[model samples]
Target: MTVLTEPGVDAAASAPVLPAGPSQNARARRGAPSWAWLGLVPFAAYVILFLVVPTVLSVGSGFFTEDGTFTWGDVAALGDPVVVQTFANSAGLSLLTAVVGAIVGALVCYALLGMNPEGAVRSTVDAAAGVLAQFGGVMLAFAFIATIGIQGVVTVFLQDALGIDIYAGGTWLYELPGLVLPYIYFQIPLMVITFMPALAALKPQWAEANLTLGGTRASFWLRIGIPVLAPSFLASLLLLFANAFSSYATAAALASQGSQIVPLQIRTALTSETVLGRENLAGALALGMIAVVGVVMALSSLIQRRAARWQS
Candidate 1:
């Protein structure tokens, strides 16, 4: 049926209906507001001033000689036997602490999981983990000394009470064994803090389903729990490794004899009274440490992505 219509009615209907506002894609492409960008200013300034500047200076100094000329001499020193051994010692110490911490911390997390989430025990452990994770440096060293050192409370009590000497085999606590104890002291708490969230993310529905399907508890863990948790576990291990690898003050205070690990070596290179031309050497050693930490963190991030997929 033909009917009279308003002028431009056909044109209006035929024309494309453009959006009343910008498309989401367009708005997203336009990015955040200017004021929102200001939020990053403080973080950027912090990285620039503290991390980036120091890292660049260290790396740049590694390539320069004592005479201020570009040279590979300092880099070459990194290949020396002593330097190689120091790196080995650091790697071994980090590995030992990471493994020990991961195992013990995982056990502790499992114990906590069985308890009421809001219980006093869980809350106290969480609070203690938070504080102990940050307890390091000279203070941590002193605490260990006061508790287990030659004339420490425990040492004296054992000596008088049982006539047994912990230092009978010599002062091993002032060596690698000693350093391992302190490193693990902090690493275990740090591991708990880093790993507990992932452990808590396990869904009960999956376990219920497995049991309903006639799967035993051991089988469920073998097939589901371990597979789901492996990434998070490895990531936590890498974090522990990096934490131990970079620690200095505790080792410095305990191992007062010489540079037993890379950090101590770097400290000696930078601060030795008789040493000359070692400033650049310190930079080279620091660069090596940076490379190790960078690799560890990179692997950690990749594993965390895998872990996130399961948790999500």
Candidate 2:
């Protein structure tokens, strides 16, 4: 076939033409639709009403005294001996639970990884973990009370069958030790959920490559595996710590006798009938808790970013 072209028309002119930038209306159409923004209204309203408002109120209340005059008295009161002890106890509990939970949960995740990914056992464990991780508050405390409290089934059985009385050692079930058990119970499951994806992200080829180089299993882990998973592990640990730090209902239900932890102390400050002008103190305590949680979460986010690079 013969074709003719104009002298000034280059072959490039035959190529398909593309539009310059989109028009204002076209750009507007490409942007989020009105309904999409509308979809976020409920969530935005929720955050403003619940999170933003409460945080503002708590932080603002902390900076004021009974006479509505600004003061640092409430914040300074956080340094009181009893308050300091409460914070120390809370930190200790969070650290203990986070460490234990990370260890146990990582072990559990490793075990799951060894199983068939599609197997019922792995599915069941994941499902159970999802449920148990969120299983806290009054119900969890009641479960513990029924199982291991002074007159609990296990306690009663041990006392009757083996002459071993759990409470004979001064009823430790209502103390810090008691709180630790329940906190760990929930913490482990949460750690499992948070750490599993990181564990799964470990490609088999890495280990195979290590073996190709005659690396021992222990050496492979000590060199590559540990280093690769460290960030995720640390992030999960921080999350567990924050989770334990902010927990309230389980501790409240168990430790009814005293405010051994910061959350309990805040509760006492806010609710004690005999105490007056402690509401501001409660706000101060909440602000401190917020700061601790904020730092932990921030660290977790940084670690997660580092982990994402490797996982990707």
Candidate 3:
């Protein structure tokens, strides 16, 4: 017996079927809620207000006169002998602190590497590092002054006990040299905080594998550890350099008499009534600082990218 189907029913069923669009669950998974971006709003606003706005104003002000007419004289002041010396001083101090801090901090990280990461000692050091790293500005300067300045606790004690005077040459604590110790003080902790993670990121499996190949500890470090950590070390060093270079308050508080560094030079330009022919010199000095810091940070970012390869 032959069966008869409804007209067009068999033909319609034979037509090719299209795939359905993504399900509601998948669409939901792919798209985030609009409110989720609210978290970034505060951070974006902060950058715009504090960093971007100030940088634009400071750098832009350099090219204009007090009358708001554009001129190159203020920027030309950067070539003044005093200004050049100040830049050199800042660069030298920053380099010294960065080198010393990076080495000492790397050693500390190495010492802590074998300790229990979650142990009391490690946790305490981490916490202390975080705090001390941020312990700069006038507070840090005051601490150093109290400890080692003329008639300071340590200075007095040494003079009385050993008949040795720290200020026999002069009161260096109030000079550019005084900044060295304070900068290094905070620089070390900052280094520890920044470099510790890179040191910790070193894989133990690599060490074991090295040993499996009959390599010694020193051999592994010399061949593997040093190479891998070099990028991170360099990056941290640049960060420390930037930190010291941009510091104003500590240097201002301690070395109040002279514009020996760029930051202090900017202060002098801004506050000194006797400053001649450079009304906007402060802005020019700030522009120079921005250039130096921008270059240093750019290098740091490039090095960090290289370091991230091994970290991952």
Against the reference, the lDDT scores of all candidates come to: 0.92, 0.92, 0.91
Q: For residues 237-310, what per-residue lDDT tens digits would candidate 1 score against the true structure? A: 99999999999888998888789899999989988998876788999999999999999999999999999997
| Candidate 3 residue lDDT tens string, 1-312 | 656667768955756696656796678776865577889999999999999998888877899876788988888988989889999999999999899999999899989999999999999999999999999889998898889988689999999999999899998888988889999999999999999999999999999999999999999999999999999999999999999999999999998887889988888877887876664888998999999999999999999999999899
CA lDDT of 202 in candidate 3?
Answer: 91
lDDT of 2 at 24: 63
Backbone-clash count (model 2): 0
Residue 201 of model 1, lDDT score:
93
Q: Please provide TM-scores, in order, for all candidate models, with all chains considered together.
A: 0.91, 0.90, 0.91
User: For model 2, how does the per-residue alpha-carbon lDDT over 201-230 read when each residue is reduced to its tens digit?
Assistant: 999999999999999999989999999999
Alpha carbon lDDT at 194, candidate 3:
95
> In every candidate, how many clashes are there?
0, 0, 0
Deviating ranges (above 4 Å) for candidate 2: 1-35
Error of 3 at 107 (Å): 0.6
Best to worst by lDDT, what's the order?
Answer: 2, 1, 3
Which stretches in model 1 have alpha-carbon errors above 4 Å?
Answer: 1-19, 22-33
